[model samples]
Target: MSTMRDVARVAGVSAKTVSRVMNNDRYVSDDVRARVLQAVDELQYVPNVMARSFRSGQDAAIGVAVPAVTGFFGYVVEAVERIARDRGVAMYLTCLGEDPDGEQAAVEALLARNVVGLLLAPVADDQSYLKPWRERTSMVFLDRRPRKLSAAYVVHDDNGGTRLAITHLLDHGHRRIAFAGDSITVPTTARRRTTYELTLFDGGVGMDPFLVSWGAHRVPVVPRLLALPDPPTAIFSANPSCSMPIVRQLHAAGRSEIVVLGFGDFPMADALTPPVSVVEQDPTELGNQAAQRLFRRIDEPDKRLPRQVVLPVTLVRRGCCQRARMGPAA
Candidate 1:
């Protein structure tokens, strides 16, 4: 275990100089900094993270809480981790994995570990559990905002993006565009469902409650919808997990005539028989921007009011929705 004293002795500098270099103080001359770093590398010295934080009265590390380390949230985690690295900030990553109790526990554990701030993609319906730590910790919500709690956050334009997808279908003469998604109680799902309905109504298309399906078993839902006497001419899936399964099921059922568009892009989405068209939200930007906001709050706790940032989205048309009406009926 190499210590700061060891590095200082090897570099022929006082321990105080080594401490200054570790803190990244501008007062340390460039020549001294180089020697200290070289000595640190050669000695394989690692600083005590908690001790460093205690000495500075703040942790340079920030904690990130997400649903999981894959899919949409995975991209966000990568982006946040990259941005944190570039900014010379440490990161503590935790995945809550669809459990409300786990979400609360992750936050508590991050706080207990003394992270300076948190970037959270919340799962809990009510975040009053975090109220006690609000004063001491700086947190920025990502993907979804906390219910009944005021905090800084970054989210995509859910309504606008879904509207774009529905409108694109409408332009292609899709009269009945079915929507497949998960439980609407989730904030993102709720916003997307609301937008899908509102778009249909605003486009002068009649809204049929039967056209909407909710659950993880969207593969079965699609077949039932297709069985309807007045089946949808096109379908809009609101999230990535729902999107991929819907496409696979439709393809397997030999129902390629039914057009499918989705809310997020996936691997090989463009490689399908007819590549999938999608409403693309920038997950990287979502994570990067959320982390940037969290860092700012950590640096200047009282500098600004809580903010809500909505990143823009675009509808990426690959071969999926290219053709005009071959008559509206499927």
Candidate 2:
């Protein structure tokens, strides 16, 4: 309950001097700073961040918006929280669902709180509505690029990673490979799906529209794909959200013979019966880099133009997707 005025009274210094000392202002003499510190310790004073934000017309907080908090996005949120805590800043997080209207509403709610910056994993196809707020808020896109808004972003190399996964399957002689993932409306999934088709075409494998499943996150598509007259020999899961459920379904159906290559690694991926091969994208690195970029923009808004950073991914082969040829299920 001890305020700056209480510390100033105890330290025999003016409130302004207390404020300067609290802010680590160099103009205050060493002796005066020492007195303020002693009084602060004596009174157990804690700075009111909310009051400070109100007075300065800025929030000492940032916002993070993502599709869901589970799986890969959870790791991203954890990393961003760590960075915010380390920097002595508060974080306000929201889940912006697949709806474009919901995405806009959630983001606008964060902005209404006067958050200094935002780290968004946007699901909306168009973000032109965020144009007006660009001048006042430091925005950084994570995991996916903004559609119409040009802003700083840190994302995985979705194209390269998808190609790597598809090529791995092709090298394993999986000509009939299926692509399972969220809707192509999602920018990341769209990029991955495009790369998946291109890689298959270049590898002399024709695209099978029947094998590609969108909205695999919400619906069980693997079983339907397996029931096809010409079932896929291998399946390329585009993201962890889709990957985990597909793997679970395969396990439940006792279809360990089918090969699977997930785009993002997930928890217990190596513990499954056939395990799981993955094109590993570092969510932690993505979150850390995006949060750092937002902080940089928040601190130095005019230092430079917004830049885009694409992090590389690697293939982590475990148990599945290693077959030399497609054969009858075991």
Candidate 3:
């Protein structure tokens, strides 16, 4: 069998350099690395990944599945690519089209491809759809997490971000605050809504069940919210996707006083008339970290550490989300 020793000798480099080259780790000079790779190709030396898995396998491929190609989704995929490049791992990119069947097919497709690990932005919060491949692959979730899920995950401090947002509105002297967006079916939406309401209650405001808005999905329901006789003083939309409809309705109704803060960052959120305030999603970092964690899990599947990585995000105030037309400072 061909060996690292033979490659190291042929490339005039040490076996450790061969390993570094194999893993795509840093610290090797480009010239020496090139020679090592050339030697690998010439020797027809395929790394024994399955054997490595059994004893010393080090596969250099990861499968990354995202729900869409929007700004946030694309950012996550880019970050995964970067991390893979840095680590000498190859990334197989899949867009799941943001649905359950699509997400399932993506994971199944990756498993069939013999991908070493998976980094997923799940389409939904159920695993029965993914259980078929769960045992065969290592998976980590991004942006949204699933119920009864066993995989390690990376996500925003969603509840804390919502609390910060609601507190900002309260400080802006908004009494009739409306939580508009998110379906109870989506855990992230439900969690943020609950936190927003709790923050209001904690601040001594009675919860107005009428002021809370929700639906079965993330479709546009802004027109309904705004047309109410007693519309909200300030609005908090949890997703950037939800903000567009909110903005369009407000513009149509000539209701600029209705302040809004979006949860996920988007391109035009800053360019709009009242540059929408946003809680930076930072999915790039999330995907990168989740990939790293999944690789670590692959390397030491029985490692005695339960890993949970949380990235920090800031509430960027712009547009109407800034201090809502500040009153005279007395």
Residues forming the 10-long window of minimal summed lDDT in candidate 3: 49-58
By lDDT, rank the candidates, best first.
Answer: 2, 1, 3
Best by lDDT: 2
lDDT of 2 at 149: 81
* Candidate 2 ranges beyond 4 A from true positions: 1-56, 324-327
Q: What are the runs in model 1 whose C-alpha is more than 4 Å off?
A: 1-52, 55-58, 217-219, 322-330
lDDT of 2 at 98: 79
With a 3 Å backbone cut-off (N, CA, C), the pairs that clash in candidate 1 are none
Cα misplacement distance, residue 109 of candidate 1 (Å) = 2.2
Report the C-alpha lDDT of model 2 over 1-330, residue by residue, as the tens digit: 688789999999998898678756779999999999999999988654434455558688998999989778989999999878866789999998778768988899998888888899998888888899987788999998998888788999999999888988888878889999888888888899999999999999889899999899889997898899878778899888898888888878877678878888888899887889999988899988898788768755678955999999999989676664545575
lDDT of 2 at 246: 88
lDDT of 3 by residue, 1-330 (tens): 577789999999998788788877778889999999999899977554333444434245778877677677887788778867766567788887746656665677776777777787776667666566665566787777755666677888989899988888888777778877756656677788899889999888877877777751255555666666766777788787676677777777787667878788776778888778877778777776887777667655667545456678788888465454433122
Residue range with the least summed lDDT across 10 consecutive positions in model 2: 47-56
